[model samples]
Target chain A: MSGTLNEARLMALYHNPSAASELDRAIAQDPAAAALVAEWRRQDAALGALYGPVGQEPVPARLRDIILQAETPANLPRSPWQIAAAAGILITFGASLGFGGSVLVARSGASPSLVADALRAHETYVVEVRHPVEVAGSDAQHLQAWLNKRVGMSFTPPILTDYGYNLLGGRIVPVDQGAAALLMYENAEGARITLYIAAEPGQGETAFRFDQEDGVQSVWWIDGGLGCAVTGDLPREALRAIGTEAYDQILPAET
Target chain B: MAVLDEIEAAIPALRRYAIALLRDRDAADDLVQDALERAVRRRADLRGEGKVLSWLFAILLNLVRDRHRHLTRSAHLVPIEAAADQGLPPAQDGSLALTEVHAAMGRLPLDQRAVLLLVALEGRSLAEAARALGVTEGTAASRLGRARAALRVATGRDRQTGTGGES
Candidate 1:
């Protein structure tokens, strides 16, 4: 019932002859249609002839190993952000572990774990003289302004004078659900503190948590739905004290 | 357990598809390796038990397309003859079918080439080819048409038929 097969339909039928019954009927009715069918069949057969059977080739053992390795938990390399989040998880749990609430559900609470994660993140990257913060504290005005805009509040760099910490700078870190702000500070003695801030965690979580991992101590809390964590090598008491002061200054309405 | 075993069994099929698509044993191996690596990495992402071959085929096609784009940009056409040594038989002067077929395939554009291999070589259905190529069934059919036509032209069969079916 056709003069010329539509290129598109011809293409479809060419790949799957079983579905081309109408075309086959048209071919049976017309000589030209019959020849087109025959020619197309030869082309298909020729294409099939191009490559010999491929089933015998060996799947390289190394390739199989690589794929299988990816399945194992240990093979999953923790990104810096994941590591930081883990620390935050610990900070949340650690605080809850100390304070004793929701003892059954380990890492479910929001503010505590989030704060904990940030503090842990701070501990990770604050000490490096190079790349301490994304935008250096040398440009304090710009750094503060940029972070203030991004973190959705006016930010005055928290002063650590009483704690012997001076502002270093800050950077941006991406988390699973949202963004994080990282602030770095260094003491005259070259000790460093990192502040990581993000949104609160799951419901019924701690307001404060202190944790230590890999020689770094972090204190984390939630204020106004924002999770904040302070990380350092300082004693847990000192870190907690620093966290409390920073939280008070950051969370309280500015006079 | 059955799904994993099925996929494990399909590895040989995947490698075969990849080999035909890439035309080089080592490169085909590399492509299969990357696909399997991804499959293992995101095992939780597997949709169902029986779709392993389709999944692997999709991954292999993506790799092939990516490499083809990269190679095309580099304009490197390392002839099939140069790459087809070792496993291939020495030209016995008779039965030029294999050589002609290889040359014909090497001349197809990537889309057409993928369709021909999936439908003709791998014996995948039009629907399966469409899924592997990430195209609609109509698009797959059209590509298959052009692929077969191109092969006919490349193999000199189109010339023997006279100018009646010529386009």
Candidate 2:
């Protein structure tokens, strides 16, 4: 059917409705307008046919690797404000059980201290020129073995397949008494979440905690002699949920 | 689970778009690479899950614009090549027909090109196109109209075989 300039324009607006009637009428009056609109429809359909099936293409392996590689090290230093607050808490109660519980509660309330470690990690290491991460996720087996050895805890990498974050790998570094383990997971969208597992300071009491600082969120808990912290740039609630999920999956299995 | 799979699924389309826009296979791959890298790194920047495709497109679009401008300014302007390079596979018989459409698309203004790509190629509604391009609905509609008209004129199909004069 011949569609008119005005009718076709209207048809474009309502992509196949009452405008069909208008299009038919316009075509009866003017064939050229009808041809023009028909061509547009044809071209639109043709282009759609040419490029429309793109969603089915497999995600490139190289791009996937690059995204998986974007995991920054979890060594961001605390901000001055966070440092001050942490110092205040450390000095005020000195790791007494009552003081530690109160401190965790107070830090959770503050929001700035909860994710202090995570944000610090993101800011510091994400921009590193040569050494963003000590261990690349590419060495999954080696990193895992090393990390497990470092923390003195035997833990399987959290199965993040359900969360759209895959375990890239892990690394080790010195902590309070011995060493800490940093396991990294990556989502397809290039977001990296780090799981920091270490031995808690013997002097400190066990606590379940969540915190946010400078937009990063972290949740930590001490279970079965190993203290674990999960950190990411996600919202406090999301980080907490992931943290809780990790805690539930890993902590119980180990204990 | 599904969200990651879907995003993983979108990478090919994203790669194709990048290649089309940059016309260099390596550069196109790099664009997709940077886009994916940023996306994974900034996944938490996305508030919720399941909007991964949209978010990836947004990231890809930004990266393409930046790289396009930088490369265009750095290198002297030249007419886009008439055909895909010899090394790349020949346009399949079907896409050969759409080559004219791609050429017409290349000739249109950038603003119009963005709208048409979002609408015709990406299957986005005009409103969605507008949102993606960060333009108003009216502007998107106007650009789309102009794009359609330009394509009609360039293809020598502005008038029917029997029609007398231009409208």
Candidate 3:
């Protein structure tokens, strides 16, 4: 056999050592092919020597956390009005901040027009194949920093990977009063979901309230000083599961 | 939960492939995390039980391609020279050849590097590597051959210096 063909056969044999008998016969016949195979084997060993230890190293804690937390059951349902009443009690104890009017409005469980605003933002962006957001999700740090600066609230975007959604980045949209941060996420199947967060000083903690408009489903709630909503064209239960996770991760603990 | 246990078992190998592919530990872990999260979320869609490793590798390769595309579009591609400087270990006696091979790998095109690492470092047959990469088996073998040849030249082990088997 020609040298080039022999090298090709030796290379194949080197990659698939399970076909060792062919390689052995070739090596016995052609010393040059044998040397080439030996060299390739050395290269393979070098590769293993360099990278095999990486696999042997201890898996990181965060990796372990991912597996352990993958299946945490969603939070139990709560009556929205009752949770609003509890929020009202909590807000009453705090020294009346100037923003109490909006807080009181939120407590009555009136669907904040913010839900409509969020849905509009979701509807507008989710249809765009390109430039879905002002900033792309790949530059997440800059996206968060930019949104935080523009929206006037310091917050990190919730990781929705557990729900099969990944951040597609976000943008700041003008709301009824001020700018709101609209963060978008998408699943492998191309379904899109969005979270809208705007500053609502002294809004207190309120349970999730579901809203549906023109085929869009949203669950909006107020926690601490942030009024947030998650909107998507998903079923109520699926949207709630994602909203609950986002709420838990984004909500600041009581101080 | 059972699938999760299987996924956990695959983490080390996934991390190894990521590290070999990206040559950055933090970036490697990040890629692996994305892959694991994806695998866990989509475990129900996985057909058959024995294909988890290849499935996870496929997920990781997709992420790597996505990341490369993003970096390219953003004009933030890290120079291979910089990557070699940052990724290589300190040279030691009897380890110079390994270090050279590692540096040369960084110089390789990402597709070639990926194929080489899958077949050589990961010990995947060319056909299995092709399946993971979503490419035809012939294309994968050719890429593997080109990758090995490039590495041979880059590491100064070309035919001129050593084996005179091929013209």
Candidate 4:
């Protein structure tokens, strides 16, 4: 019970029957130790029985879709006509408004494409009834932690209850630069709003720029290397208030 | 394209590991989905020599660790009783024993539980488990030893007393 049958040797034997030759000989001689090994083997077998079939179960459609979509040619570079069309669309609706005394010095970065992606994500996900978000709002802590790590920024989903919106949940969407976090909220009337955050490396602060396309309104800005946009179908003033509140909460105080 | 196929092939094992870790099928699939997303996004960074399965597991273990830290900080532990019956096989004669073992697994420290699952259930070598866990082989072996010992003690108590202690 005390000598060669230490826990380490026993574990090595458990993992590999041929791991320790001397330990095998010792277990054969020691009945008590041999009994312990037998018990562990039985337990291990039970563990196998309990979990082995989980792998054999069909992989969920969502999981398979992720792999399939990642390989699609849709992510390839856009044609010149496509770029011109996008720019024309943005110019028609984009309105740059200066915030008096609150605007930090502006720096160059890719905000236009980020906004486009965020708006597209909002349109795509907000319409889904069965799966609005990847992680549900009831599991807020897990969702926040996951977004923080994957999106490479620390942020808390702003409390929108004061604005009559409750958190529906959030998902990680891919962007041109990296991953973006999209948080969705719903009001009593079933209207939804989404907040999108992505890293805009080396980007400087800017006043909120409002954009409207196909009746969907958005307020987007860059502060402290992070680009954020709040998109919804609400009126411009209402969306601005919510977006401003989110900006105040999500931006680090020192920044 | 080949990497995507490899990812598809590894899905079953990943699901198995996640289910064993989280118990709840929905939560496990969520974890698998997140891992797959991360893997596809970072696939270009994958070196030629690294095995795709191990790389995927490493990503998953990192996510699991993050979740545990978040849960600990929020003090919102998944209710053991509510989660106990999830994804379990239909009860047979040994159902009680299986339940006892399942409950005991929920009690093991996260690190120990992970080591046990990787080695015992997944049939991984100690070194391979260590690689996936980002730990030294020696550390992984010691964790497995402690996990097995803890499991035995927990299940043994249930057998002797007819009812197991609740956490």
Best by DockQ: 3
Clashing pairs in 1: A11-B141, A88-A116, A88-A117, A92-A112, A92-A113, A110-A201, A110-A202
TM-score-based ranking: 3, 4, 1, 2
Poorest lDDT segment (10 consecutive residues) of candidate 4 chain B: B158-167
Report the lDDT tens digits of candidate 1 across residue range A1-255: 145655565455555647767766756766655666666655555444445456765445555444333322322425786567547765664674454333322543444446445644664465455566668777978987766545544446677779888887887665544346788888898888888876443334356776555566667765665667787788888888898778777654856
TM agreement with the true structure for every prediction? 0.48, 0.46, 0.53, 0.53
* Candidate 1 lDDT: 0.64
- Model 2 scores a C-alpha lDDT of 0.59
Q: What DockQ does candidate 1 have relative to the true complex?
A: 0.26
The residue-by-residue lDDT of candidate 1 on B59-79, one tens digit each, is 878877776676433322647
**Across residues A1-255, which tens digit of lDDT does each residue of candidate 4 receive?**
445576676666667745767657767887656656665666777788778877878666567667756754434434785456545544543443233111211321336676677777787678768777878888989988877756666788888999999999998776654477899999999999999988776778889987655678778988877789899998989988998899888865773
Predicted complexes: DockQ each: 0.26, 0.25, 0.31, 0.28
Off by over 4 Å in 1: A1-4, A17-26, A64-255, B73-76, B82-96, B160-167
lDDT of 1 at B126: 84
Q: How high is the CA lDDT of each candidate model?
A: 0.64, 0.59, 0.75, 0.75
Using lDDT as the yardstick, the better of models 1 and 3 is: 3
Q: Give the per-residue lDDT digits (tens) of candidate 4, residues B1-167.
A: 78888987899999999878876678889999999999999988888753898889899999998875553233225556633555555435432267777777877777888889988888777878899999998899988877877777766632432222222
Off by over 4 Å in 4: A17-26, A82-255, B48-50, B70-77, B81-96, B157-167
